[model samples]
Target: MQVLATAGHAAHGKSSLVRALTGMEPKEPGPALTGTAWTRLPSGRRVAFVDVPGDPRSVPAVLAGLAPAPAVLLAVAADEGWMPQSREHLEAAVALGVRSGVLAITRADVADPGIALRQARERLAGTPLAAAEAVAVSTVTGTGTAELAAALDRLTGRLPVPDPDAPVRLWVDHAFTAGRQSVVSGTLGAGTVRVDDELVLMPAGTRVRVRTIGCAGEPRDEVGGVSRVVLTLRDAGPVAPGMALVAPGRWSPTTSVDVRTRFGEASGRLARRMTLHIGAAAVRVGLRPLGPDTARLTLNARLALHVGDTGVLRDPDRRAIAGVSVLDVRPPTLVRRGAGAARARELASWPDRPDGALVLRRHGVLRRAELTGMGCAVPPDAVPLNGDWVADPAHWETLRDRLAAETARHAAERPGAPGLPLETVRLRLGLPARELVAALARPPLRIEGGDQLAGGQPEPEADGLQ
Candidate 1:
């Protein structure tokens, strides 16, 4: 089903328009009584309509509905033209990546729609919906309702289908108890859930069994992503609206995250405390600046997060401050003095592929198998050092060069001093680990006996030094 959210200013006839579009048929399935509704097209296609409040104060609700819907129906009042709330809603929609939508000019009977249409186009100019189709309609007189429906069909028809095999994340927007069973409803993001499948509730590791799944008021054995689902859970405990039902062992709930952030056009330097909204969860967090556009957020509650999930950060006053892109869900603690700067560098150099090269580059050396266990692909060019350790090719070369120079200097200064003690060479290079020293023991530099390093040419007097 294609989900279309109605976004516009308050009193713009958004809810009235959705009722008109869906005919408010009590017999129809889906969320017809609330802000969300659904209707069947002539082609027998069902399109879900999410009617968002037009008031600026309702921005959070609009954002919550927009999280799972890919398309929108931006409603504009014919007489009022584009209000301040309209612009804010549009900006929020665009920032949230809702680009596909149609413009609905309601209450056209009260004013000439030609002027409103022109004004709507002007407001949408240079925005994501610059080319969106606009139509004038009246719920009372029913003017242009057919055109609006056709436009909605076109928009929903063009929406991309959700992948069923992807990772599953269902953002719970509503939770209640029904007949001794706990019910939760939301748009499933990916993967499929079947009856009797155990789903893990995030932030708290509570596992609940799926008793039944319903869509459009019909029971189903399984449901896939990109669809609205109402789930009745068995043996569940205190289910709530900000929680998520996810496949077990696939995600981790984390309190601290390192993110790449982009400040909004109206955003200022973020405050120490802010509200972070991801999926349907909103929680306060402490912001630690890692860079100008990056931060380490310490969430008040753990959230089941993954890399690439986009969230919005708002100040305590509920003003949007920045858009956050998850770079690392499991961020390291900035415990040391310069760890923040060092962490920034490490995240800056993160590669697209989890190839062990970046990890090795950052850590100097790691156990080959351990790198793979961290979801890193060991590059084919990587060479094995010692028994199970691996070192990046380039890093090992640099280490080799530094060790040769340091060893040669130590030998030259002492004339015939026994090849520098392995411990001394290790200490001089500032590498405290024996594995780090072993990584530099490749060709052109040899370990003399078991305790000394021969940098360049070996002296005859130094042969028996060990």
Candidate 2:
């Protein structure tokens, strides 16, 4: 199954287009109706249309609809070629990285769709949807609807294949009680979800089991990525919008993140406070600019975020929106005078994709599992030292040299004392475990006994009298 969201101004036939394509009446516009409508095209491919409201007040709902969708069905009315909400919706789509879609000139029977199509193309120029196919449709006369459907079929066919085995991160756009059970629905961005799979709810960390799975209004044993899904959950306490269900033990819910702007320079110009909209979740955040294109966001609440996650930052006071790409979820604190600028320099060197080696280089050493939990993909060739701990080769060499120098100093300070206690050496070197000290021991530095380390040749034992 494929999913596409409807983005356009209100009363611009967004709902009418959905009704024509899916043959189902859209639910009243709200945060809960993000991905409720579905249809199957002539090519035998199932597609779900998320009809989002275009009201300026409902910008959050529009963001929720576009967050997880891979493509869009951008609607523009012939009579009203382009509008304010149309630009806003298009900006939201570009911010969320939506690249595949169809431009539908709706209500063509009332006016010349040629003008609307040309206007939309002019606005879409240089955006991800710049080359999107356009179809002029008139639901009143049932004209061009078939062509629109065919265009959508082609759009879905061109969508990038999703990884079914990737980690699941389903953003809950709607949650409600069905009879005695709790039901939640959202678009599955990646990975597959099964009936008995256990998932952890983000920001709350509540564990829940999937009692049932439904997709496209039909019950199923499991469903894969890039599809709209409904799950009846057990132990789903306080499930609501803006929360996410992710693979248990695989995500880190963080309150602070470093991001790169997709729209414009964020340095010293954006509001100090803004609301971050990502995957149906919206939360207040404090912004601290790190560079012209980079900034740190301190969210009011924790969010299960990863590297490369895209979202929009809206300044409520000015109603300004900026697209952001998350760079680091576990960002370092900027308490020193020049730390922020130095961090900006560091971030400037980072690639858009997650890099485990880069993470290890920054921290010196980290547990392999901790790195992965931070949404980093640990390289297969990474060598682990002292069990799960992986150290950067250069950092580890520096630590080894420091260890040798510290051991020699300890021996020189106490000529007759047993070489520094293993725990003491570990503490002096700021090593997390004493095992690392042993791992760092070289030819001249060796463990004297089970609990002590010797830095030099051992003193000769006094010969005993016969």
Candidate 3:
């Protein structure tokens, strides 16, 4: 289920296009809808559509929710032609790295046939929609409605298929009540949203039971994958847009971001303090400039940011610097933007050794994946069967030295032993079994299994002792 979104300047008829395409009447008043409301196609293959209000004031909220690879729909009123906000909206969509979309030329009826079409083409010049994507339609005449549907179908075909088995991550884009029901509207980025399914709201760590599900203006048996869905929770309140309900252990907190930030008129060479809008949460951060293209930032608030979490960036102070994204949050500090960023992070003195393994030494245990990643697979004899590594070459050598010392101390105390016993060596090393195993697996350190233990050499088996 590929994610697609409807984006455009104010009064461009994005909401009407959504209603026309997906059959859902999304919050329209007096022939216009001014807020973002995401909806999904009921088709088995879920297609999420975020219908964002054209109002520039709500750009922060709308941009915050324009994530997980959304297809931008630029609505242009043929008669009104292209306006300043149109370029801004298109720029925001372009900044998001989703250049492909439908250039919906609305009010085709009112638009003069020859002049309006030529101007519309010029307005969307150099865009994917410049040729095939633009669909001129008048809701009243419905002249090009079928053509629009066909174009969407063709585009949706290129999207990745949604999986039912993956973790359920419903990014709530809109939360509102219709009639007596309190429903949460969100896009299914991937995985199924089912009835009675237990989903957790991220970072908040609150759980809710799904009481109902819907897609494309109608009830559906299953919903998933880049889809717009409304899930009625058993016990929930004010679910809010940009909230994610995902599988356990799939997300984590991040305090840093790697991105190439540019200065638009709205963003005047960002200063230190700004708010980051990343995947369902807004975090304040202190920017540490590493170079012109890159910067290191520390989040002012704690968020469950994972290795590859994405989001939008906005300066709360400036009205215009309100849209940015395309970043890897809480990552291992690779630079996509900025000069000397790598050099700066390196100068910050990061260890080359596996820090996770070292931390496990202090903490006692680790998940299997962590151990495997560090090359620490121990045997029944507590001898390391794999090698440990770190980013800093110095730390790797230091770790090996520590392991050798621990093994030697154990051998000296025990006297005439080929290998150190597991418990004495671990206790003497002041490390958990996992960490000890990881350290022993370092290239310079070696552990062998014998009657006692083996580190330096094989104990000479005497006939009498045998």
Q: Which candidate is the best by lDDT?
A: 2
Question: Where does model 2 exceed 4 Å of error?
Answer: 28-35, 178-180, 421-424, 447-451, 456-466
The candidate, 2 or 3, that scores higher on TM-score is 2
User: How displaced is residue 250 in candidate 2, in Å?
Assistant: 1.3
Give lDDT for model 2: 0.86
Give lDDT: candidate 3, residue 215.
Answer: 67
Which parts of model 3 are misplaced by more than 4 Å? 1-3, 22-24, 28-48, 113-132, 176-182, 218-221, 236-238, 255-268, 319-398, 405-466
If ranked by TM-score, best first, what sequence of candidates would result?
2, 1, 3
* Prediction 2 TM-score vs. true: 0.93
The lDDT, on a scale of 0 to 1, for candidate 1 is 0.74
User: Could you give candidate 1's per-residue lDDT for residues 1-466 as a string of tens digits?
Assistant: 6777778888998888888988763222223223557788756778777676666666666677776678778888888888887877777667666778999999999998888789889988987789998889998999989999988888777778887876678888778765567888877767788999988887787988999998766799998867777898876878777788887756657888777764373222678788887887888898888766678889999887666677778673856546677776656668899998888776766532334565566656667655543445566778677677777787777777787678668767888677777888778766646556755765556777887776564322347658
lDDT of each: 0.74, 0.86, 0.57
